[model samples]
Target: MQTEKITSLQVAQRAGVSQSAVSRVFTPGASASAKTVAKVKKAATELGYRPNMMARAMITGKSRIIGLVVAYLDNQFYPLALERLSNALQAQGYHILVFTSSNAQDRIAEVISDLLDYQVDGIITASVGMTNDLTARCETAGIPVVMFNRGQDDAAVGSVTSANVAGGRKVAEFFVSCGHKRIAHIAGWAGSSTGRDRARGFAEGLAAAGMKPLAVIDGHYDRSIAAQVTRDLMARSDPPDAIFVGNDHMAFAVLDTLRHELGLRVPQDVAVIGYDDVPLAAWPAFSLSTVRQPLNRMVDATLDMLLAQIAQGEIAPRRIEFDGPLITRGTTLTPKGPKQ
Candidate 1:
């Protein structure tokens, strides 16, 4: 819809003040007298003259925009997180400029430079494969960059992720305690930080109980890949009595593979578990046992960390990892005694 153009000069003329006064009133932290501010408001109201944040950004060379990089929007978790991040940033009077990468190191560098060219106040990389150089560049530019979901050990980069290793370990401990002797894994993409940490932790947890898995396969965080991986693992010389899939998304395919394709009953022939207890995990069709990452708390922490860094010009890099809870459900066999 076409709207009326409201110029600052017109506002100043109506308020009987200089144009600079109007400009100062609109700019954040700009000095303007209370009387002038009130006068500009009155004039703006009369003429429906709204200030343009984008236009002001051009003059200050500060876009107040965040660069949000996502590897694949296909994953329901990412799309859901994207929506929440966008809404949260908007509420904070900032906007997001989205970049969809193929999780490539080269492409990520290019995308980050472009976003920097636009003078974004901060950058958030949700992609699993963002390179070190890209993050270093953002650090040099004095723009805050936060790694969410996937993170690095470098303290120079602020990261917010679920305690992947701990969560994975919890799943393993639960399985072993419930008397699952023959366990297998449909692991996440081994290339990503999330996948590796979970894998390591799961193995560690199993070692504590002195029970090793029958087999483990890399799922690559893809449904088709996960299904194929599950098939191979389960078809081994001695298939596992229980299985742990990387996330809820891949777990669904594993379930289908076992029940429909392989004709195996869950928890009887093969107990199953997954991470990221997404909405569908609770659905009757899936009813999957999984680990729950406190989504709201994670989101809040990420936003708060980014905004603070942006406001302070720069911040000491830090990693903030939160724990996830193991949720027991229908896919696994509950122990006979009191809950382990």
Candidate 2:
């Protein structure tokens, strides 16, 4: 059996308002008085008149949808950030279309091309890189793209990230103040800007303090790999007294391997610090000392940048970096001043 669908005109007739008023009541960011809005909504409720987003989009040239691309969700920080971003977008009367992309450039290009076909208002990519050709296509289509927790050399793209360099330096300062001479760092994926920046800063900070890392092993942001590296670092003839891991996700593995497998005591035998103070870091079992990336602030900043582009014509791309504070816990020796 076939059924007829209700139209906006019928609701307008029932509410004793014009079709234009009915349209305003249904459209987001459109203006209608309270009485008219109430009457139109009441009529719509009685008639079960649902707005067709596809038709509306055709008329207004706006889908009110932003495409979000993410490479990895393994880290707790990313999941939390995604939730915050979704909520913030919803509050602004916008919707999200999520696409998962792998680290592979070809897969990322395909996902982005699909997003463009859907006519998304904007895009936000987390931990994914875009090629110059893809960037040119997006520019030609007049779609603004913002990278979150990632960086690109292209000036046409925008990004928001914590000051990884400063965060790394802070960790080095803490280790030096705590009198740890033999320090090493289990680095994140060397390909990532966040990873490279953090490693460079840590090394420079150590050098400035008249200290050099005993070893710097690339963990590639993998738990099993980081654990294996930690074991290898321990087996060295002159083992490190302290280690700074790139992120909390891998730090847990490093901590577990050092304590359980190697039978080493934290702080007493080997101190550990990590980046991204995820909730797991606070668990009684770990009590990890780490640098805290301000997720809420980062999310807010990302949205602001995205919306500004959506409002104004695409302007010069800008990069915003927020400051992250080091949170000291049981894993590292306490410094003289109060932890930030």
Candidate 3:
């Protein structure tokens, strides 16, 4: 048996309304009166008619889709941020198409090409870099791009991120205030702006205190690498009394290594601090002292910048940075006053 598909024309006839009225009811961000909307919806339910977004996009030349590219979701901070971003975009009548890419230039180019092919209204990249060539391509295509939790050297590209440099400096200040002389840092990937800014700020802060890190190793934002770095650091004749890891994801691995493999007591033998106060940091097992990235605020800022670009079409790019707070927990000795 064959069944015919119901159309908006039929729905309008059944509801005793114009075909345009039925369209307004079905199209997101379109206007329609309450009576017309009620009638169209009722008629649509009865006839099992649904709007085809693809066809509408073809006619309107707007897909209402935002392509989101992320480097990796291994970090807890990213998953939470992505959820908030998705919800906020959906509320604004835009849907997200997520694509994951490696740090490689070729892979990122492929991802950008895919986004352009899809005719995405805009693009948001999380924890990924946009090369000048790729940026040129997107600009030529008239697709606005915003970087979330990442910054680019190109002033033309928009970015929203936590005050990573300030956050790193804060951690250093906290460690120094605690009287930790032999301090070391397990830095994030030096290739990233976030990592570079944080490391630079940490070094500057330590220098201001007339002290320097025992060792600064690039963890590359990997758990296993961080764990190995922890071992290598501890094996030194004069090991670090305190270590500040670039992120909570790697910090967890550092904590595990200190406790399980090295049989070291946290804050007793070695105190550890990390950036990005993810949910797991608060757990009793870790109780990690960390700098909290203002995830919600950052997400909101990203949405605002992205939507503005989409609306204004090639407006000046924005660089937004929000300060993060330092949270002290069991992993570090609490200082007198409020948490740093």
Candidate 4:
């Protein structure tokens, strides 16, 4: 009453090849001659035979699946990074299972546990944090974990990040070179390493220039909160001549607050510089001056480390940092020399 499922054996018989040859043709990273592959593929096409990925994985002891956990997508950068990672992994014969977690610790833990249950070959966490217990569990499960655009104090955890501190320092130097005397900072949440490192570098840069910021407030990487902070800063009689926001997402809100609500002209009444040169920063509406995080390079490094650990059956955690350039736009003054 029901149709029978086609298998590799039937495909091999039709193609005049052994079952093992058909398997080699279908399996990822398996060796097979071009003629054999073509014959097997033709037979598979004719018979409508699709290889069972799960069964193949069982034979290899590798799911060849990566778990991607991300926190927050309001920032355009994260989505772009996710796309790059997905495409890159797919090309390397791997697929990804994505899980979204709020910045909440418990939610992230739950998602990590779910990923582990699926027996993914490795995990990549973007803008998300993991607890000691969860990290331990992952290590015990022999799963390699790589943090993308995030960092932890634990030496056992691997991470890839743009040079946040250096980028921040560059922003400060740019502000100083532009002759902005009263500078303020709307920082990302201090709890995270990216945020802390950026703040530290900005301060150090300012000190190097023999200047100090008017104020440094936490924006928590939120648009509305950044807007509110911008309002409060502008309300002061001695407001900053320039403001450095942690990232371009918040910088947009800060720009809007300055232009619409406060009736201020960018780079005239106040200058704004932000980190993460996201695509929106180049939009005609918001030509924001910001630091460019090399997303492609970062993604490449992340994949390289993740795959290497997976292949080696152990993770000797390493931190990879890439230098990012600052892109100048309409929102900030041109430096004395050639513009970046």
Instruction: For each candidate in the order shown, give its overall lDDT on alpha carbons.
Output: 0.86, 0.92, 0.92, 0.92
Write candidate 2's Cα lDDT for 49-86 as tens digits. 99888788788888899999998899888888889999
- After superposing candidate 4, which stretches have Cα over 4 Å from the reference? 1-3, 336-340
- Shift of residue 135 alpha carbon in model 4, Å: 1.1
Tell me model 3's lDDT, rounded to 2 decimals: 0.92
lDDT of 4 by residue, 1-340 (tens): 8778899999999999999999889777889999999999999999999988887777787888999999889999999999999999999989999999987888988998999888899999998887888899899999999999989988778999999999999999999988889999999888778888899899999999999889999999999999999999999999999999999999999999999998999989999999999999999899999999999999999999999999997658899999999999999987666668
Encode model 3's per-residue lDDT on 1-340: one tens digit a residue: 8788899999999999999998889788899999999989999999988888888889998899999999999999889888999999999999999999989999999999999999999999999999999999999999999999889899879999889999889988998888789999999999999998999889889999999888899999999999999999999999999999999999999999999999999998899999999999999999999999988889888888888888888589989999989999999975546677
Candidate 3, superposed: residue stretches over 4 Å from native: 336-340
**Strongest candidate by TM-score:** 3
lDDT, candidate 3, at 194:
93
Q: Model 1: residues >4 Å from true position, as ranges?
A: 1-5, 11-50, 338-340
TM-score of each: 0.88, 0.95, 0.96, 0.96
Q: Which residue pairs in candidate 4 have backbone atoms (N, alpha carbon, C) closer than 3 angstroms, thus clashing? A: none
Give the alpha carbon lDDT tens digit for every residue of 1-340 in model 1: 9986989999999999999999888776678989999999899999999887778778876776899988887666787888889998887768889989877678888888898888899988884555667767888898888888988777778888899999889989999878888898888888889888898889999999898867778888899998887788777888888988888889999999999999999978989999888888899888899998777777888998998888886568678889989998899998656656
Error of 3 at 294 (Å): 0.8
lDDT of 1 at 81: 87
As for lDDT, the candidate ahead, 1 or 2, is 2
